[model samples]
Target chain A: MRVPVLIRRPPEILSSEITDEGLFLNRRKFVQAAAAVGAAGVAGSLLRPKGVRAAEPGQDEDKLTPYEDVTSYNNFYEFGTGKGDPVKNAHTLRPRPWTIRVEGEVGKPTTFDIDDIWSRFPPEERVYRLRCVEAWSMVIPWFGFPLADLLTAVEPTSAARFVEFKTLHDTEQMPGQRRGVLPWPYIEGLRMDEAMHPLTILSLGVYGKVLPNQNGAPIRLVVPWKYGFKSIKSIVSIELTREQPRNTWMVQAPNEYGFYANVNPEVDHPRWSQKRERRLGELFKRATLPFNGYADQVASLYAGMDLTRHY
Target chain B: MNQVQWVRRVLKPAVFVAAAVPFGLLVKDIFGGTLGANPVEEITHRTGFWTLTMLTITLGVTPIRKVLRLNALIRLRRMLGVYAFFYAFLHFTMYALDRAVFSGLGLTVGAIVEDVAERPFVTVGFTAFVLLVPLAITSTKGWVKRLGGKRWQRLHRLVYVAAIGGVFHFLWLVKADIRRPVIFGAILTVLLGYRVGVWWVGKGRRQRAGHVVAAGASS
Candidate 1:
């Protein structure tokens, strides 16, 4: 069932030119490979190939997109906007030179490099639905440790009631900065309990592969219950604080964006109805599920609060 | 008016240039695949907006000609009209692909078209768009020669009706934020109003003169 494409292989281009143009193909080829691999994808299945171990049901990692899909195609603004932009642009990010600074209401304020942090917390697999503010939602199987586990290791002080995360602020890396739409070096925050919630994950990879730069490769937060923006990406710093943290989107359009940023049907945006969403892949087929249908798991978090206010 | 002609000659590109700035940015974002999520709507809205914009410009051409005392202002009409068709085609495609238009839900064409009517904005927008299809087809130079100058001018007056329909289409489409459509509507009204006022006043004076001549002859 495979058809061969005729290609006349000429002499390879020089290394510098190869880096310039040839590097783009690696990302393009990654997509081509994913499409090829998808040829074997059975209907409505999460990539359970023949003879290879299928992820068992109830296993969080079982229903995840492969890591190659996760890291390469992402919405991590720290790297860039498009799923492909990250892989193409993240090389310039200097993940090696990156170090996360932690402070605010902590007895032992610690600043750690990417190496020290990963070696300690390690990566765990969690299948979570990422619902974007713009109405598209996706089911991603992310590989990362729980925010609670990481916080426990760091020992947040009792005074630390809020946890704020900051993305790397380089006008060079984050092209959105050039436009100044929502203040650069995007910042997001969560209440202390929400930050420590087991459902909250600091994503490292997806689909059993490393994270795509666009998908917040290297590191990003994944809050399954809330809208995806609450799950910040390309994190460069973490601050433990008592006061409310300044978030980018909420600051820009307070009426449209909310602090909790949960997936709720009752809370409609200024322009569009939140009552229904287009499920990914089923975008042309099925309608979206409400609370992204994790209401059973996350509804308790917003039991008494007026969702309209939080919305 | 030599200076005036020079300015307008420069401004013809400037209008297209101004129009293209947004298209370029949006295109770059889309082509770079940087439009993020819900991409289909992003492209739809962008293209739809330019459709209305170019239509507004096309409608503005005649008034601009009269107001500026420059006959050459009429020259931009053809190019602007074509651009309107270009963007309008994009807008039409977006809607046709939407669930409201051609649903993969196995809905009948009658049902699909009915669903579009159920949404008032879509209904009005569809009406305006359908009205433009005839205008677009008749814009050819051959069609101009075929209809003859007077008939063709009469036929192309359909562009005025299309412009009004297009603005109303945009106004109906939005649920809130009437500011944008209202601004566009005001501009379109002024453009159309200029011609209507001139026609009405000229007709009234001619009628008065005819009455006087008839009375003089009778007396």
Candidate 2:
């Protein structure tokens, strides 16, 4: 296995250029401005969600969830399955000293330090509505770069069709791992194209600060358009594979959770209706949007496929 | 007034107020903005908890009276069961309202009926609540006089079945972390166990008495 670092890509193939043509043309200027601000140590403050300054193009303008809600009400089941369990029990997690093993069918199978990945891909604020499979939603201002950038750096092989993410599995820190609620070392995966989608981000921060431990600190996947569980937390490994990898939730209950796991209101989970969702901190439930309101950007990915059957 | 009258007028009213405190607090929390994030869930969770709590308490009334000889506690069981139904009603209403936005028609009979039939958790909970309706209605003195004591008692035994359904509803709905529902299940087991034990011991006593009478007559 070989390890690689920050392999620069052609300017056109950049994940940032894939979005808007205007933003693509102004990429150099944005990078220069970001570099200058990054040098001054004001990067953190600049990325903070305040007014229109933190609003990114092609993202939701919904009111961001309160920092208290974003931090306290979490679904990181490693700590525990309860909504409040992570807040109370994740104190034992040591996020700083962490390394992610990036391997499997890539040109360079590398072990990258969490900090290295953070610096290599400068964080960008993306306000996303995170809808959990359990029918609750929250609009979170996540700070991270695209997963495409990370995959680009590692250089996936042509044979690689899926990317699997493995979460931290320390029983000492994550008390819930000791019990059999879910298979330990929770696993989640995405198709190669879905993994390379511009909206799929490797989140490191929320509300402009480094993530709280309970909210998957160090590093985590944030696939905004999919169910929140698809965005695996406290990631420890990224493996590119030829075959579709088994996801934890899907493995536990296949009928309830499918491999696609896209946010589709039309296809209901076996246990409950998916047409509506309770947005956190909101009084009334809101009608769920197809692909979590990212249908324009992501709907084509599933063209000609039977979503109900896939679901 | 004497002690019996004092207990009837003052103590019974006190129990009623105390039993109502949870619902009042829930209402206050809704208006006070203190139910925290996801107020719908908070409302659902709290009301569900109180429903099960009151149901368990109601099931324990007979056992408590028999053990401690506090027969006046029998008067309080009706109020306790009513509170359980009241909370269950609130729980069902909040759940409907929570899901109503998805329905084409808002809070209509069709939508509720569809949900009750479609979702297993809702089905069980709705069945439990529907069972409680007759119990609450027949709890009145007039209904008791009309139905007669034996038939009334038999119909009221359905509360035990309703209580089991409520627990199963809770157990089935949880995504993960079955600890809370499991704890509730344990409590129900103990309450039901006490009732079965009392019946078994009484049957044994009756059998023994029959044998003794037969033996004396033969001798």
Candidate 3:
């Protein structure tokens, strides 16, 4: 007998949900052609919002941050610490021919080829508001499938309580790893429930094109309710563990960064205020919301736990 | 032309133009839409960087003059220090506008006061800026003469303290990867170390001179 469905799949695509086949096929061909020249060419072509779906209900209604900003202004320490460093340095990262090994506390441990996973779960477009701990925010349209689909396929054991992710550790490709800026191969984790949440997606593309190398090419986690750092980048391996896994920032500065990095405006970062955030390209700063404004759906996950203490 | 005339007419103006280039470029970038996604942050960082850089160079003036025997370089120090203050003022203004008015905090003094009081980085940065204010005001020749050489010299030493504060402000602000701050700290250490070395040698010389005077009188 088949194992029970561990997590819900995204709802079936309705007849109206389908796009014009000819237009979709042409767009795909154009993306492939751009990809042939180089990643740089693809970057220029993909930035235009052509054939992108509208924001799903409950997604942020704010204007999407410019693609240049999303790709240029990143906090990927594996590439470098400066916001612009990733765009300059991430060209060293090779995204194709990548594989993710899913193992530990799973009934069927498997290594998934990046292409296979792409074909297996056709990406769905999602607009999410990503708020950084530094009090900057962005509205991004990410194209990817629910991560629950992967975890369900692996069939997590009952003992598994946390899901841990690891970025690639090649110093040649990721030169920033050579410097002891942070513990190498940047690691992040989420509670099993958080991992299985419908909002958590394994993003392969953004702005209707293949993910830019700077913005965690190949695959990255996008947990909208959590701080941007919680959504780890360039994931190479995933492990389900019984104990809560210590994330990179948590390891680096335990007092400042904690396991549950849910966006809570009430809890200020020790060094700076978290009550307000400057949405990229806006002149005025806006008051930040609870769970980056997804409290309605995600607040139940931390019902009785003290967020300030966890943070 | 004489050395002083050449410095006044040619060298000083050249240094002033060179110093102002970063600010000019920043304005150009702001207008050209090349400051990237976060232009405010870009402006803040660039201005702050130039502030610290001018402070470091100001501190370097004496060490370089002594080592290279290019005392003409002394003429440039006051201008450099003034530039540091200029950038510090700009940096702080950017922050105030970003935090107070643009942030929708209604330009209340309380918002800025709270930031200075609550954040250690802001505290140190504000301290550096406050220390520079008097130095910049008293930087004119007339004020220097009124204060007298010894008093002015002693007062100007506050630049060292301001430099220390500025370096720490930078060190504390970054989230991680402190290579840049550490580099600034290392350079400051060497500059401060040179001063200590000179002071120690002068103390020894003075003590030896006193001994010679005593021997001469006894004989």
lDDT of 2 by residue, A1-311 (tens): 01111112322222223334244325433543544422111111211312232211222325546677888888888888778889999999999789999999999898988778766877676667899998888877676778998999998989999999999988987888999889888999999999998888898876556778999988999987899889999999999999899999999888789888999899998888787776665444567899999888888999999999987
Question: Candidate 1, which segments miss by more than 4 Å at Cα?
Answer: A1-90, A283-285, B1-83, B101-219
| lDDT for each residue of candidate 3 in B1-219, tens digit (9 for 90 to 100) | 877788789999999999999999988887777787777788899999999999999999899988988778789999999999999999999998887766645566788899999999999999989999999999999999999999999999999999999999999989987989999999999999999999999999999999999999999
Judging by DockQ against the true structure, name the best candidate.
3
The TM-score between candidate 3 and the true structure equals: 0.89
lDDT of 1 by residue, A1-311 (tens): 00111111113222122223244335434544554422212123211113332222121211223333444545555554444666677666555556777777777677877767666776654556677766655656466777877777677888999999998887776665565446777899998877876677786655545555566646788877788888887788899988988888888778778888888767777645565454343224233345666666566767898878877
Record all residue pairs in model 3 with backbone atoms less than 3 Å apart, i.e. clashing: none
* Residue A156 shift from truth in candidate 2, angstroms: 1.9
Write down the DockQ of candidate 2. 0.21
For each candidate, what TM-score against the reference?
0.62, 0.82, 0.89
Q: DockQ for every model, please.
A: 0.13, 0.21, 0.42
Clashes of 3: 0
- Model 3, A149-260: lDDT tens digits are 9999999999999999999999999999999999887999999999998888898877666789999988999998899999999999999999999899999999899999
**How many steric clashes between backbone atoms does each model show?**
12, 0, 0
1 against 3, candidate with superior DockQ? 3
